[model samples]
Target: MDPVSGELKLFLDREKIRDCLARLARGEDRRDAALIRASCWPDSTSDYGVFAGNFDEYLAWVVPGSPAIPVTQHVLGQSYFEFDGALDGDRACVETQVISYHRVDFSVEHRDTTIGGRYLDRFERRDGEWRIAARTMLYDWFQDSGVSVDWSQGVMGMPFSAPHFSGRAVGDHSESFFAKGKAR
Candidate 1:
């Protein structure tokens, strides 16, 4: 392939890999198993520090809210990619920085935990599709804010009193929005 075409292909591959990362993050936050599954190969492996296992085990531990942390948001940052061989190689090593916020509701207090981390991933292109073949989560820093927001009082102490005012671990407001065909 010519240099220009090869560059374009590499760019497209990068985009695909980025999309997979986004899918994985969103799926984990929403606890959407199908979307999470689409981000990885069937035989993928994951080492999440607290949980390390095959794809199936990882799926079960991550989806449907394991560890009982009800709410989470994963903010993705810069990603660096390294192709296995030439630009046309089917495998790539990717490292993406992430900032994650988790709401941990304890028996007596609600705490917000913010974690700075990176996802080290091995991406493999199979059948013209890019997906994660292996992944490891590396934690850099963390902070626990004393208390989380009390959603019952609504935002800033102004009561809205509307259902779905706050996001849920399951059946979040986004689910209905997506069900209405708002998301692709």
Candidate 2:
């Protein structure tokens, strides 16, 4: 292949990998099983400390609503990639920084936990599509932000009453927006 075309292929492959990561994050936050499934190969494996298993097991553990963690969000940051070869290859090692927030609902009290971490992933291109083949999550730091916010009162005492726009584990406003075929 020509140098120019090879470079373009590399760029597109990198973007595809990034998109897969974003989709995984969004799926986790929304508890959308399909989106999460699309990000990984059926034979993939994952190790998230609390859970370590195959893709199916991981999906079952995360996609279902957990009473302890009713809400969660994952903010992805810069991603560094290392291809198997000098040019675009079928396999790559990727490390993505992330900040995750979880609303922990306890019988005694409700609190928000923020965690800074990195996802170490091995991406494999199969049938011209890049997806995670293996993944492991590493924690860097964690903070317990005592007491969750009171959404009823609204943000900063400004009565913003729009239950339909609110975010939830399932049936979130984003779902309706996507249902209208607005998403790509």
The predictions' CA RMSDs to the true structure, in order, are 1.7, 1.6
**Model 1 misses residue 16 by how many Å?**
0.6
lDDT of each residue in 1-184, candidate 2, tens digit only: 8999988988898999999999999999999999999999999999989889999999998878586887788999999989998685799999999999999889887799999999999999999999999999999999999999877677777877687644667777888878898656
| Candidate 2: residue 100 lDDT (0-100) | 95
lDDT tens readout by residue for model 1, 1-184: 9999999999999999999999999999999999999999999999989989999999998877755588899999999999997877999999999999999978788789999999999999999999999999999999998898888888986997687979767778898887898645
- The clash tally of candidate 1 reads 0
| lDDT measured at residue 33 in model 1 versus the true structure, 0 to 100 | 93
